[model samples]
Target: MKNISLRAGRFLTLGLVLTGLGLGSCKKDDTTTVYGNWTQDASISAPRSESVSFVINNVAYVGTGRNPAALSTNNVYGDFYALDPSKTGSGWSSVTPMPAAAGVRYGAAAFAINNKGYVCGGYGYVGTSTNITYLSDVWEFDPATSTGSTVGSWRKVANSLPTPLSGAVAGSIGNVGFVGCGFDGTGNTNIFYQFDGTTWRTLTNTYPGQPRSGAMSFVVNNQLYVVGGTNNNVATTDVYAYSTTSGWALKHYLRNVSNSTESYDYSAVSRSLGVGFTVNDKGYIAVGGSTLTTCYEYNYADDTWTLKNPFNGSARNNAVAFGIGNYGYVGLGYTGATRLNDFYRFAPNDAQQ
Candidate 1:
């Protein structure tokens, strides 16, 4: 009987150890994968904000905007740069800059279709004549023919936005591209417009989104998600999603839950002009005004936000971001008095939680 009791105890011990190992394996498999940190990358040649960026044929291109050092003091660049993420050490290559007549300025909207890129709108100031000029011209850049280090060529599109826009956002879905919500000189407009390679048609669908500028847009699963920006001097947490099925509807609120009553608290510092980009099906937004550094991830399927890794870079606003393959590149923006030029690449890892 004593021998039998010892054998039973050993069996129990083995059973417990096996069960613990099985539970550990279950935890590892059950945990939802979170993303990783932002790895610093080669910096762009110039630090800027209110600029525009788009991807075509797996290459990312950025250009046009006033530099922080010269903003309001007199200086805006039409300079363009291109980067191949697969070859990060090669850095950003200088493309042909925008011409004077093109009005290559900040706050403009940009998108890519069929391996070509289009840039339109933005506030223009050349040499301190305080009159404030907004642009409605449109130009298309094609890098398909360029060989080696040579940049692309640009030709003016036949059609342009009927109303001049600044601080607008642009994105592409399928074969067409769309532009929306910009400051049209007098005030903010909520009009939605799309371009089909040649013609520009304004969609009459009234986007209930606050008519404000500095908002940013990103694409995930062929849908466009527009996030926070200022509307009528008040910053907002209103987040909207637009697609063919629903023209435009509020998706998820960009706020945290309040301890009291467990209600959605809309009072987070407004994340206007923050950088936004997508990795896989998840969209990540971070580092805008109000000295914000907390990054939030939006799950479109569930409409819930989960905290991801905070931007490991300096806190800033009015930054620009674009994704290539699975990685998102964020860089160049204003930090109150200073403008930042540091660029970083983000990759989501499963253990980020």
Candidate 2:
């Protein structure tokens, strides 16, 4: 929370003159676009924010964050639950609770690789008090064999992150998981790291954008993209994409689809602490705008964005979201006044209202 890290990206003030150059922009036409419906899903066991979530073989695993404790706000726990998108009423069941070390950390980054689920580096409190600790530990959860609510299956795999971090994001591309940008307690970081299921290492190149945490991250077509986080409390629209073929590049700027001139005035995606997920080849981002109710879909192939169905639940931030088969599920977040347990399922091809 130092002013120094927050000041790192100070140059991105409004109209700071960023452009697409060779990047092609897509403008949405009313006739060509239809939004999906956000139907309610089974509520989670707890209402929380800063939780970590990812999908493994179409089953979504959501776990680890604090529930409200009196007026204190943070009551961190490490329980994980499995939700099968195909199962309706009793859709959720308990998995092993994360170890005391892993479950208590909030703002940790998460991803699914092969058949294993990983949660890495987050913010946690010490000894049940508000004393803050930045964690860089990496944990692996294998649901293929884990049972009950017993803390048994999770095992720490690496030494720790290069540095203690919170609010960074992790996504798998091929067999490797990539982690990027988070508050290191002293400052926000644009630094990046990679985990190969057993070890953690740093990527040679640095992120081209400002250092930030709480950004939305998901994978598409075997590539990873990180977007939309606050820097020094100001929401950013910059997106930095990374892959083996290309390092970090400012591929395309987020502009309003209604503005053909690449005007910032037309975009509504500039918020932080929202949830993001990938469905097939495209990525859907929702519920992170400053006061969010709108949603958008990103077509990375054309470098274009189209507005999709907005979230139907009460507007919330820091919610956990993930994709299962053809649909995306989002839920469990804070609404500023209340921590929420309501879950919603988004079907992108359904008839629009």
Q: Best by TM-score, which number?
A: 2
Error of 1 at 66 (Å): 1.0
* Model 1 CA lDDT for position 232: 88
Off by over 4 Å in 2: 1-33, 69-74, 101-103, 126-130, 147-152, 256-266
Task: State, as a TM-score between 0 and 1, how close model 1 is to the true structure.
Answer: 0.83
Q: Which runs in model 1 stand beyond 4 Å of their true positions?
A: 1-34, 69-74, 125-132, 147-149, 256-270, 350-353
* Per-structure clash totals for the candidates: 3, 3
How far is each candidate from the true structure, as Cα RMSD in Å?
Answer: 10.0, 8.5
Q: How well is each residue in 1-353 modelled by candidate 2, as lDDT tens digits?
A: 00111110112223234324433335523144356778888988778877888777778888887667342325776778888766667677888877765537778889888789988888775445566578877888887774563523888775678888888877889888888888998999988888887777889877788887769987887778888887898767788788878787775555443243443332466668887788878887889764787777777886656667678899987889888878888898888668888899888777444
TM-score (C-alpha, index-matched) for candidate 2: 0.84
- What pairs collide in candidate 1? 35-348, 35-349, 36-349
Clashing pairs in model 2, backbone N/Cα/C closer than 3 A: 78-103, 256-266, 256-267
